[model samples]
Target chain A: MHADPKGVLTGVHFLDGDHACCEGTLAAGARFSAGYPITPSTEVVERFAWRIPTVGGIFIQMEDELAASIAIQGAVWGGAKAFTVTSGPGFSLMMEHIGYAAMTETPCVFVNVQRGGPSTGLPTLPAQADMMQARWGSHGDYAIIALCPNSPQECFDLTIQGFNLSEEFRVPVMMMLDECVGHMTEKVVIPEADQIEVTPRRYTKLPPEEFHLFEPREDLVPDMVKAGDGYRFHVTGLTHDERGYPSMNVETQDVQVRRLQDKLKPLANGRALCETENLDDAEVVVVSYGITSRVAQRAIQLARAQGIRAGKFRLISAWPFPEQRISDLAGRVKAFVVPEINLGQMVHEVARAAAGRAAVIPVSHAGGSVHNPDAILKAIVEAAR
Target chain B: MNQVTLEIPYEIPVDAHNPVEPFLRMDRMPHIWCPGCGIGTTVNCFTRALLDSKANLDKVAVVSGIGCTGRVAGYANLDSFHTTHGRALPFATGLKLANPELQVVVYSGDGDLFAIGGNHFIHAARRNMDLKVICVNNLTYAMTGGQTAPTTPDHVISATSPYGVFEPSFNLVALAEAAGASYVARWTTYHVKQLSRSMEEVLSKKGFCFIEVLSPCPTLYQRRNKMGDGLDAMKFYKQVSKIRHGAPTSECALTKSGEIVVGKFVDRDRPDYLELLRGQMTESLGDRYAEPEVSCSC
Candidate 1:
């Protein structure tokens, strides 16, 4: 589908990551958004409120994050591509609705401009501490897509992909941006409307009487109908049947929960987004993401100059972990050095994927800032030994 | 008092045929509401009102938050969403704003609306988003088993308030009026005839229209407080109710045994959210801004 011309800026301009993200959302055809402003993430919605009027979209500052989160789902069911933006404290409040969107299979995006936090630790600085929380924050068994953007340009580019993946999978997609990337100024190129590709909402062509709200097609994803489309369908947060009514049997629970997990299983490796460099004969591999990946590049160069064999692995998609690539590298490399802007989050996944075949070293930061290149270079040198 | 269109029949002719069945998911019944529960009656009145108002059923969508009355979304034969606890208003706000053509209705309970969802309730009304809200106030969180509710009158016995509810209850009518609802009414279940007529009037009106239906929870609220049964509550409404049309919202607070004011207190027109948004955008942004197309992505 062609992007809505009104929303597409269609030009190259110097913009912050937050402002670029708003442009990306507009180009993706999200006509509605509800949010409560939180730091670092606030600029995304602020820019949106200013530009959305020209594009004929609604940007509502809801009561709080909980209302913001659930409100977007309602807009989705009403036939609008919608999203919400928040930081850690707001993201924590939105966890239940994230699970609600997962359980009900609502297609939306949650942009978390992460900062240091156990609880509101550092609102002004950068941190990737919410990586694990983004994947497993919501209770119950469900998997969602999360993408990490390292630059203001990727903040615009990846947001388009995030919305696409969210629509394709019928699940909430997380745009994991740090406070640094969200605030940093850079040139962002927005493609023209015709050049920009959008996956339009897949509305069911089935008649109202024949439509079963939760009944999936052969693709294993059910087609959607908007509210007031005369479907008169019922959708609930409780464990529901194919008819979208609450059913408490063990059989129904198994079917419903299994489908939520199964739908994204294939996308784990097939649609996994990452960048790799010089891994063919590396003695040690560095796995990194977010702004840390940019810093890791410098570390890899420093290690190579010091007569150490090092390669770089930059993760663009943070969840549905690229286990296939990581596991394959575990057999070839002597060790894997994982550096993230948090205290050992994704390193656990790396360790699990490596499964004792190679030594896994975690370079943890207590957040509030990104890792120094030397600290990562030190870990790469140590892992190489 | 606002005019009730006398041309429209307030009650359904049950003897001729079941007019309400077509408006309900018949297979989903018998409903989960306990006997003597006022929700069933409210649902019936809602269905009748929808029919009487002559609104297009295809363009109506119902949204509900968690609690017993929240189940109305599931039972309604409409494009309905049973959303999260205390979030029906925002959900409806999202739906209504995104699809301005659709008639959005928020149907839920006191705890869902006034307690956990209170912030949304006030903000939505303050914005004057065009939505129809039907709140079944049973005085307690009946779904959670006789828990103290925001509408639980002082001195009422509840499971959470084992001795007695020492906290004062919310004056819902006052809250709605203060928060800037364009249409606000309060009626007990015993006034089904009047309540149904009120629904008929409110359904077609614009802006934030609210109807607080004082209901009875036979199993939890009544049984715990020794308020007899649902029948006793109905009789109690007849005894203590004062049919005061256009009463001041401040004096309309419900007490344990005080005379309950029941009538339409507010029904005046003002620019809704969408209207104000369009006006501001057209005035400020001018040629740069365009209104959204009606048949969006259809």
Candidate 2:
């Protein structure tokens, strides 16, 4: 479906990542947002609050992160595309509702502008520590899509993709941006509304009598219906049957929980968003994402200048981890040099995907700042040897 | 109050049709509510209120949190949501704001609404959000096996208060009024007629409307306190209840075995959240501001 022109700002402009994300939210046709202010991520909603009033939407500053997170789901069921934004502390507070969204298959977006963490760490500094949490923080055996944007332009681009993937899979999509990207100013080009493709919500065509709220279609996603639509659908956070009624049996749990993970297998395979370069002839690969990925690009160039064949693998979709692509590269590459702001998070995923076929070297930083390019270059040169 | 053009019938017809059945998910019958629990009785009153108010059933959405009373949303055959514990108000706030046409109702337990969800309740009421909140106050957390709740009366015995509760309980009606609810009322299961009337009144109102229904948790709250059963609790309500139509809520706190004050304490005018938002936006933006369209084009 074409983007709603009423929401799309069709022009090129200089903007920060936070402000560009707000434009992406509008372009994606989200008409309702509820949020609480948190550092590094506050500007996203700040811009949203200023812009939505003119774009014909509502932005309610809720009581807290817990309320902000679930309120968006309520708006989603009311038939509006909705989202919430937060940083580390607020993101931790929103974990339960993220689980609730996954359980009930509510489509929404959660934008986390990452900051140094473990409770009120450097609130103004960048970190990729939340990459692991975005995949597993909501205490459950469920899968979610997390996208990492490296720049202000990609922040604008991936946020729309985040909403589309959320609607397509009926799961909450996390737009993971670090403090550097969120605060850094850059130029962003926004195309016309017709050029921007949006995925419309899949509402069921079946009559009220025939429709089951949680009955999965062939694609394993149930069509949705909004409130006041006379469908009289019931949706709950508990383990439920296809009819959307709570059934606390082992059998029901097996069917419901397995589908939440298995349905996203396609995302793990072909639809994975990754940028690869020089891998066909390279001996060493530098795997990275978010702001750290930009720094790793410099490291890859430095390694090649020293007569070592090093390649760049920039992860755009961080979760569902692009396992197959990494495993494919693992057989051919001699080593993988993983650089991230965190001590060692996604490095483990890279190691697991490599599966003893190649060496895995971690270039870790304890966060508050992005990694130095020389630090990653040192690891790449050692792995190449 | 948003006036209902339909006239209030002088005598409500006692039809052969079961009023509650059509409003219930009969397939999900044999509900999880314990026998002798008064939560079911409140649901009965709610369904009758829907019938009396001539509400568009399709437009009414029920949202509940986690508790014995929270199960009402699951049984309700409206477009319902069984949400996380203590967060129903915020959820309902989203539903009501996203689609102003929806008559969003938040039905849950005292522990869910008054304890963990206390902040959301106060903020939502302070905003005068257009939501009808019905709290089934069973005095304790019956779903979690009769733990001491924020509404447990002083000197009452509970699982967490084995020695006896020293803490005070909330006067929900007073809290509702103090938090800026446009309408606030208190009733008990024994006052079935009045409870249904209050529900009907709140349904017709536009701002934040609160009705606290003091109910019996026969297997837990009552039994733990040595109050015989649900019938005995109902008789006790009949004996000690005082019908104070406009009494000050400050003087209406409940005791373990004292006079139970039941009444509609506040009925006042205030602009709801959406009204203030739209009014302010339209004034500033003028022709540039367009009220949000219903998200579903269908």
Candidate 3:
């Protein structure tokens, strides 16, 4: 389904990553947003608050990140596509309700423009340190979809994809952009509304009496019933049955929690969005995502000039790990060199997927800035040996 | 002990006039409330208000944070959301703003609303978000076994405050009034008729409306204090309660074993958060602003 044409800003323009993210959400049929101001991520909501009015959406600046996170879920339940944004500290605060959204199967998006962390490390600079936190910050065994955008252009493209994935899977999708990409200005080409396909909310077709909130279809995703629709359905953060009532038991817990994790498996398996180049006859593959991909590209070129056949594997969707593709390449290549803004985060996943089939080299950066090309080039050279 | 009753074709006839079943998830009964708990009385009054208001029940969405009273959302036979601890107000705000057509009601206990969620409560009221917030101020965290709450009266013994509460409690009436709530009221669970009437009044209000029902937690709060059962608490409310409509919120603070000031305190006209949003957008953006979509997608 296409987005509501009125919300789609159909012209190409020079925009920063933050502005592109706002336009992308509008083009994805998002009519509601709740947020708190945090550096790097603040520009996303700032642009949203100013521009949402013209397109007939509401942007609420909530009291804190906790409220902001849960507020987006409320909007989703109330029949509008919605999102929230934060940096690391605020993202830490939002962890509880992110799990709530997962348990309730509330389709929404979160934009976390990462900065140096553990604690408010570098607000003005970039880091991918929160990559692991984004996957497991919320204390539960639940899965979420996260996308990594390499530039302003990908920021626009992937944010729209984030909303589509959230709605399709009924999960809180994260668009993990770092401060560098969020503040970086570049040209973004936005297609007309006709070309932008958005997955609208899947409202239930059953009548109110027969509609079951947690009853899944063959794909394991249940249909939704929004508030004020005469479908007096109940939704909760507790272990619940198909009737949407709380049912506490080992059996119920297993069923409810397992579904939350398993519902996305089929969607995640063959659906890792990435850009690959020069893998055929390559001795080493450099795995990177987000801003690190740009830096890694330079390292690949440098390695090629030195007569090493180094391939590029750039991740667009960072979560669900893209394990199958990585594992296949692990046997084909002698080693995989992973670079990220963080100190050995996504590289661990890469190492796990390689499963000792290939030697995994992690070029860890302590995070305040991007990796130096020479450091990555040295790893590329050493890995090929 | 149960074999005789089970062997008998034992089924008591249902009360045909139990008007509350339609408003509650009857299949989930008998409820978790203690036999003499005042929470039931409060729920009864709320159910009465819902019945009398004649509002579109489908358009109403009830939300609650975690606690004994938070379970009210689960029991409510409306579009209900049972959310995390201390977050009902902001969650309800999202519902109201996303679809202005929803009659969003936040029902939770004092600990959930005033302790962990205190920031949200003050801000939601400050924004005057259009919501009907019915808070059951049982004075302690009853669900957690009589722990001291933000509304726990000074000198009251609780599981957390065995030496007696040294910190003074919040005057919720004054808090709500000062925070810019458009409507504020207080009553005990004993005041069923008046509580129900206040709820009806709040349902039609256009901004944040708070009703504090000083309910008795017979199992936890009452038993810990040796304050007799629910009946004694009702009798105490009848004896010490002073009906003072339009009283200043400051004068309505509850004292330990003192006069309970109860009445409708503040009612006024004001633009809700969403209303102000639309008006400001229209004034600045003029013809370019598209109104937010509010219909529920069925």
Model 2, TM vs. native: 0.97
Worst 10 residues of 2 chain A by lDDT: A48-57
Residue B16's C-alpha lDDT in candidate 2?
A: 44
Best of the two (1, 3) by DockQ: 3
Tell me what TM-score chain A of model 2 achieves: 0.99
Residue-level lDDT tens digits of model 3 in A235-343? 9998899899999898989988999988888655588888999999789999999999999999999999999999999988888778889999998899999998877
Decreasing lDDT order of the candidates: 2, 1, 3
Report residue A11 deviation for candidate 2 (angstroms): 1.1
Model-by-model DockQ, in order: 0.56, 0.62, 0.65
Q: Report the TM-score of chain B alone for all candidates.
A: 0.93, 0.93, 0.93
Best candidate per DockQ, number? 3
The best-first sequence of candidates by DockQ reads 3, 2, 1
lDDT for B35 in candidate 2 is: 77
A112-230 per-residue lDDT for model 1 (tens digits) = 99998989889899999999999999899998999999999999989999999888888999999999899989999988889988887778888987889889877678888888778
Error of 1 at B171 (Å): 0.6
Q: Candidate 1, after superposition: displacement of residue B136 in Å?
A: 0.3
Q: Which runs of model 2 end up more than 4 angstroms from their true locations?
A: B1-16
Candidate 3: residue A229 Cα off by (Å): 1.1
Q: Report the Cα lDDT for candidate 3.
A: 0.90
Q: Please name the candidate that would achieve the greatest lDDT relative to the true structure.
A: 2
Model 2 lDDT at residue A245: 93
